[model samples]
Target: MRPPLAAVLGIDVGLLQSGMGGVAGAELACAVSNAGAAGCAGGYKLVGAPLSAMLDRLGTGTDRPVGINLIPEVVGAEELDHQLTQVLDETPPHVYVSLFGMPDDKVFDRVADAGRHLVVQVGTVEDGVRAAGLGAVVVAQGIEAGGHLLGTARRDELVAALRAELPDACIAASGGIGSPEEAARAVAAGADGVLLGTAFVVAHESRAHERFKALVTAAGESDTVITDVYEIGWPGRRHRVLATAVTADPDQPKKFIGKTVVEGKPYLVPRFSAAVPTEATTGRIEEMALYCGLSCSAIPAETSAADVVAGFAGVLPGSPAVTN
Candidate 1:
């Protein structure tokens, strides 16, 4: 049997409450960490003065291992690139990354100067090996994920493949890792740890809107769809969001999926095709669409982060089965 993943992350926070691009806020980041899960912060849309406010808020909360997911796709764009460069230059987190390979050498070097550990997300083993060689920890995210898939390769296959190469670097698995059992599976598959975005997005403490939470709660294993519509971040990258008018667009094939942002790193644009027809229906089902993973099936309704963490904690990789 594979050993239970020992906690060497130094994260006083649970390490399970990862933050999200759209949902992660100062309150959620600190609270989850205070609750014993590693607190994480997402800064995809944040730039300029907003960066200060975000960090200030995070400081108000617990001081656990905080992460700032810097998807190069957003900041690397021609329009926002400069501002992104400056904002990221000032970030104070212990961990940082150039999402979808954005920020490039300039940003990576800066993070190192600040004495921070950099984690790079990759979709291919080639990228993994290269990143490891560059001295950045690698996160092998699969395609079955919610927000963005940084890989151009197959997620499942890449997970096992990357393990063989970057043995010394810390490897965390993302993409469709929504449950404790799924986490255990990844550890069993040899991942040093797992980073779950969508799973925590639906938690009660999550800053995601109530409507967004409902969609995740009502969803089943087979309910979500992966598509390229409403994406302006990463060009060919796709994500699993609630099957709404956006993904349901019949014109998806004819028209390039509408990308909202320029960097187009992992997700392009993210406007849901469905929305409450009226303010009354804001929380209604038909109007709300959210990003989730294939692991959406295992989540319970409106649960607490601690309970959720406990549930997932039990799903640790079991001992390898004995052969006859």
Candidate 2:
């Protein structure tokens, strides 16, 4: 028989990567997957050529199962439909994840019929229950998570509530998970898997800017802030970013339209969109959304994705050793 949902989803060690936008690209995704952890590529802001290239790399680079996360609320209906069409038509990710909002009926049915795994991230116990009912794995994201703040409950509380409420549902924990001990604690608290963002954000294979990674490495536990400063296409969404000068922008625009270059091509998008960050992008790095969780202190100065998976392996039940 196929293993339970956790194993089948490559979350056997109870570890997963958070698929941060512009950060969790192919190199990082492949590295995490090769380490036997589920790595999700952020697909919410990507479309057309850029989206296609990312999926192509993920598909060709790794033998392990991978996933792609999408935020339905920010993509808008027309763009969402268009992106979904491109994904299904060109190169669909191994798993399709919908965050902030549930997938529409057509997308849900399409994923189901295609035998692809679907995951829904919820902020509340009620939403978790709804995701379970829809046959999608429920990612119970706590406010401590980096990038986007999802649910209101603490990670442990959310896992316990979900386990108690939905006995058969497979629940994953996100937020404030940065070390093996943290991952173990989440599993012990009733989570089948743990989703880590900040830990891998500093991974050697990650595409995060050097300064971004350095800030995370040098940060302490008290360095994070959840603010709506970067709100543009998706307003009122509080994301956990490093407490930086840019977050202090009192006159931050509610909605901004601008042209930013990615990979040497001009792309028009909302300002502060996570995809705006690239190796070539310059100026105002501090002003950009510096996504991070509360666990920056737990990250070592230098580590690879494989080592990250290994760090948590020893704590997981029946998991293999972290090998080089």
Candidate 3:
């Protein structure tokens, strides 16, 4: 049976996972909650007092349920978890969604101890089943998602299989979801909710670099390619982004990139890919990491987060239900 991911978060079957990257600051998370939606922060990498500060702002911003995306495999996880636990103990987020690697139930138990929920993002049916088996109430199946694909399953096929296997778990569909129709389709396809990242990245409230926003707006319907060619932060997983200089430009020299350790630290960052531009059409746009989904073409315009939510607020099943 599907786990009680939705009920734990205290929301309806229909929901939205705030798509905040490089911009999931406290303000936006609270803004999402204030706008009749949920705010999620994937801040496992955030460190020092700044992490506490960010969580403090999020707590003070709104009374809505908030979540953080945690990848257990990242170095210094223990410290990060400690900080997260401290913040959750004080501010008490609504949930904690984890990915990138498997998290033992011991972690889930810790989240539950905070009186919070636990949601896990998965890419395949096998992973989903394992998540449910491990006591994760929420299952986020990401397909064509912007930042991290979860790299597991085909969106439609996996959704159907997961539904049949974990009927009781709260299933949320993510990846390449940019329109009301897609959101509705997720629900009709057995997903209890929808998670959008790229669509929100261009929102008025989003802090995404102006140059990046412009590129997302300017990208043709068919733009977006997933490549791990020059990755630094998370190795092994190539991300999808607009054709940028860091990735595109055939004549550009292949700069060095790989996992490394500096000053007792472990992580790789080559000079060439590290200096990518953040602006949209600076022409250097093609040289930076601008994660986006293939569905970006359907985004009507660069608008406010509230307006984007409102656009799909009334959307419902249009086409007759098709058996999965």
Candidate 4:
């Protein structure tokens, strides 16, 4: 009685971890996958050597099926094509690609042609149907999700709508889902599985900044806000983040507030940049964009990714309770 997505992805449970940039790295993804759930590494604008190295690490880290998240809006067509090509060529057949926004038909065709699985996270029923029509496992993302939002629908509503439209499609719910009870609610609303971002942000293996983890663990239900203020790198997309001083008044001075290193390269993080604070970041970390979701209330402290996966495994349909 396992969820359809679990069977499709060859995992024991239907739970999937978000490919949170800066936070979800090889360690976190491997930990989650090892715990009988699906895990995905964030591929935020990564290309060339960095992307290749990441895929190599993931391939060697765990034999379990893992995913690489790529956003279509972040990179141009040429770079995205390169990323997809590298992913399909360099990784084994078990590795799949997950996209944040609706990709063109060519992207879908490329993955199908390569015989690799593709998962698309969409924010609307129409997008879900389209993705499903193109032979992708659909992940319906609500506005409550962290990072860049896809649409303005609520988690349950979108899940139900997608289910009604595509009865046989593998639909996973994302956003505002932290606790096992909340995951159950999503299932009750017709989701075959649940995808979590905020809960994984506080995982012990996450690469998020220590202060950022602490702030998320201490956040309340009402401490999150959806804003488009931090849009320097990836613009025009709204994201849910913790209520910070910068968010309170977004008109602050446009100066470099921090620095982060990704794949051996260093980049200066300017004020209102969409970069999340990672362990490699140094500067006014407090003023940077701290992406968080309403599910922060369920993240009490940093724990192992296995425990986070175990907590949600039991809530999935027909999945046995997993122990960390």
lDDT of 4 by residue, 200-305 (tens): 8888899999999999999986888999999999899998998889999998888998899998899999999999999999998988889888888888999999
Top candidate by lDDT: 4
Number of clashing residue pairs, candidate 4 = 0
Model 1, global lDDT: 0.58
How many clashes in each structure? 29, 1, 15, 0
Ranking of predictions according to TM-score: 4, 2, 3, 1
lDDT for each residue of candidate 2 in 110-229, tens digit (9 for 90 to 100) = 666767777777778988887788778788888888877765688889889888998878788888888777877887787777778889888888877788788889987788887877
**Deviation (Å) of 252 in candidate 4:** 1.2
Deviation (Å) of 85 in candidate 4: 0.8
Q: Which stretches of model 3 miss by more than 4 angstroms?
A: 1-8, 93-101, 249-285, 316-324
C-alpha root-mean-square deviation, candidate 1 = 6.4
lDDT of all predictions, in order shown?
0.58, 0.73, 0.61, 0.88
The total of clashing pairs for model 1 equals 29
lDDT value, candidate 4, whole model: 0.88
Better of 1 and 3 by TM-score: 3
Off by over 4 Å in 4: 1-3, 321-324
Over 76-143, each residue of candidate 1 has an lDDT whose tens digit, in order, gives 55534554454456554543333444345665666567666666777778877877676665677787
TM-score of 4: 0.97
After superposing candidate 1, which stretches have Cα over 4 Å from the reference? 1-8, 12-18, 77-102, 152-154, 232-236, 250-289, 314-324
